[model samples]
Target: MKNLARTARWLLTLAWQADRARLLKAIVLLTLGYLATPGIALALGAFTDNLLDGRLGATFVIGVLIALVLVAELMMGHFAHLYYYEVGELAESRINSELIRYVNGTPGVEHLDNAKFADTVTLVREEIQKARAYIEALLQVVLLGGQLILTTVILASLEPWLLLLPLGALPPVIMGRYAQRSIDRSRDAAVEQNRLARHLLHVATSSSSAKEARILGAEAALKRRHERSWREATAKLWRGQLAGAALRALGQVTFAAAVCATVYLVLLQAVRGLVTVGDVVLVITLAVQVNAQVAAALSVLSTLHAAGHTLRRLDSLKTWPTREPRTPAAVRPVPARLRHGIRLEAVSFSYPGSDRPVLREVDLDLPAGRTVALVGENGAGKSTLVKLLCGLYEPTAGRILVDGVDLREMPPEEWRSAISTLFQDFARLEFTLRENVGVGDLARMGNDDVLTDVLGRAGAEPIVRRVPGGLDGALGHGYTDGAELSGGQWQTLGLARSALRDQPLMLVLDEPAAALDAAAEHATFEQYAGSAGEVGSNGGVTLFVSHRFSTVRMADRIVVLEGGRVAEIGDHAELLASRGLYADLFELQARSYS
Candidate 1:
């Protein structure tokens, strides 16, 4: 109950914040319409009595007045719908914006890929239009109740027994509530299935997956799986619909019987001369309209219940499980300069939902103004270590320290602001070349001189000379006449983007030259190392990962990682003299070159 109240409060607040004027206009018009409904039956009765009494003038006036009332009702209804549409559009925009901000703002990318979160978001989005009118739904129910009351009063005035209209209307509302519960249960399962089916269809059709799918001859298999998913999902929903139909049929039978009983009782009253012919006509008209009004009011409840499922989803979005936010006590002011250096003491980590650790206990120090290279075969935890340094993930067992303070004592945002990174899977953003390079460091993004120097350092000068628009050309095939680069060219642009941050405290390059030829790779890494070492007194530490031993030899120190442990750490000559894993790997590469 408390949760429902909280959700209602949230939706009400969201609606008011989105647009108040339009909301007020719609509700007022709708109320007036509801207030005018019972009056129409009264007007009809008045017209009948005047004619029966042989007062033709009175009859004519009432007839004209009835026509005017109907026209007024029609006008109010028209304006109400118009205002609802406007309010709906604005509310959808506001809701989507807020949802995106909160979801993306949560620390890290884990929850973004969570299936439950995806399902909830998709369902809420599908019902987005109805969800926006939460406050209006409450107001509608109240106004509908008012219409029912006014309708009951008329039926009672003719004969006290006519109040049975409400009782007869009760069964349909009860049955509808049952149907909605079944639908809600079925809908949850259906939504999950639908998402999976849609994903299969996308994988089969999307260009990114086409090569692999065709190579594996899985196109027909994918189609069959999608069809099965669709059939299963729809089948459950169809059963719910079947149940609802059954309920509606039972309700309709009771409704028809109520109408027959009301007619019989009114005729008996007329034979006894207890009520006039006008009163009989009024009772019959009020009964039908009143029944319709009850159904309308109940239908609002059914709609609200349907929308309530989506409202719950919206609430879940706000409560998604996430990494704990840094507490005030845990945050310490970062120093203006790197003091002793950054150290990882007994650090170990495991990804979420995994039992095995990716990185084991290991101690390493990156002194100020030094270049450190990390080299390891696949799954040796080199990239994981870099992720830890970049604050993308925290160690599960031990912690890292900056100078002498715990790294956690500084805020993650502060830590990130002082560093730049180029990951192996660097994003090929579908933007202009300038935007792609400048996006790495937004503060200096507009400075063309900074972009030029960074591009030179990244060996992207050749790419610039090849393109007609130079830095201004659109950088991907997704845009009109966009310039698509070779893999090496894309790597060059990525390196330039990372280098745009003029003086980050730390620079991490994870295979930054993976696609470059041997000579180009050597030149890029030399520039990266030399430039990082020139930061003077507060020079940042540069860390890079590479499989090429020739390039790795350029680092001031090389750390060889093996099976999630640092197996050897020394300069190129020292590690070679030690005759360990690093020496063997280096010798193997040298032989290939010879």
Candidate 2:
């Protein structure tokens, strides 16, 4: 009951904010609708009594009362449905907005990356609509319970033996509670399976894996796996429901027998001259309504139980902590510019729940006015190091400092604004060209002059020109007037977006041009190099991560990573002179072209 109250209070508050006027109106209409059932029953009984007495005036009066009650019931029922649905939709829309805002703006990338969090989000998305129906569900409970109460009182006035009809409701109430617990457990199991099934569906249908699956003839296997997962998830739920249905049937039979017995006693009273014909009709009519109201109340309680699961999931989302302690031990603001530069002192990191550290005891320095490049084999932790620099993930051991201040001191958004990055697997958003580029800095997204400059700097100008609408053209092939950009084209657009950051203190470009042709790649690097040199020659740092020696050679310094440790750090000339791992990798790459 405590849990139920909490869920009810939460939904009521959400609905009240969604539309105050509509929700209040719905409550009034609910009362009117429930009143109709007993009103019609009583009016009919009185009208029947008048007809039997053969009094023309009394019969006419009772006839008018019955007609008025029926018409009012119908009108109340119609408007109640309209208001209830409208308010429900409004509540749903408001929740969707909140959900999106929380998911996107919530600090730290862990919630977005972790599997459990992802599954929770999926369940919330699926079941949030159930919460939107809370107002109607609550009203149904009260309306039905009130009908049962009023029916019991009316029947008791006719004959006290009719009070026995309401007592049979206890058995159904107990059964409903049992069914609710079983259903909640089943839903928990199903949510886990649903996440797995959705993953399989994505693998089967996603464009990235479609070709590979078809080539390997793995589509059949994927379909079978999906079916198996769904079966496992839903099997227990279905069995429990079937058992619940049987129990419900048994309970209803018991109540029906009770109803019949009550009417039999009432009829016996009329035959004994203890009551009139109208009294028998009222007792019988109210007895059936009591049974229906009991069933309706039970149903509403069960519905609320199911919705409680979704409400709990939504509540969990709000309180889920990010990777960092949300509140800082000592909060400090980041400066607009760095003077002594960023330092990583004995930093190490591992993914959440993993034993193997991706970066082990790494030490590095990015002094304010230099272009540094990181060269490493796959899995050497170059990307992980970059994430640390960007504060995407915190170090498992050691600490990072920026000009003597702890990296954790700075707010994430402020730190993010100070740096521009182009990750290897950057998102290809299907927005208009202007919107895509504008995302780099929303404040300046509409600045046409800046947009044109960034595009030109990233070598994305020609790509934009190829489309008929230029920067106004929609990206992606799925929508009308949307052009499917080539791999290099998309890469350059990502570059353009990264470059949109104005006078950022740090620039990190990870594999800046993997898809471009050799000539285009070299041209972009040289152009970007020139731009980065100007930015970093001041109190700014530019870092690049790539296997391309041509681009790495342009950096003022190169750091070679091997086995998650810095194997060597020097300029191109100095590293080649030492003929260590950097020289070996550079030479190997140089031989590939020859």
**What's the TM-score of every candidate structure?**
0.85, 0.90
The per-candidate count of clashes, in order, stands at 0, 0
lDDT of 2 by residue, 366-477 (tens): 8776778899999999998998899888888988888778888778888888889999888787899999889999999889999999998887878788866878888986
Q: How does model 2 score by TM-score? A: 0.90
Best by lDDT: 1
**Model 2, residue 478: C-alpha shift (Å):** 6.0
Segments of candidate 2 deviating more than 4 angstroms: 55-68, 101-105, 243-254, 323-329, 466-469, 477-481, 535-538, 577-579
Could you tell me which 10 consecutive residues in candidate 2 have the lowest summed lDDT?
Answer: 529-538
lDDT of 1 by residue, 329-428 (tens): 8888776677677899999988766789888997998887889999988999998899888877778889888877898778877888888899998888
Best by TM-score: 2
The regions of model 1 sitting more than 4 angstroms off are 1-7, 47-71, 113-115, 125-130, 133-139, 167-171, 211-216, 240-272, 276-281, 431-435, 459-493, 513-521, 535-537, 573-594
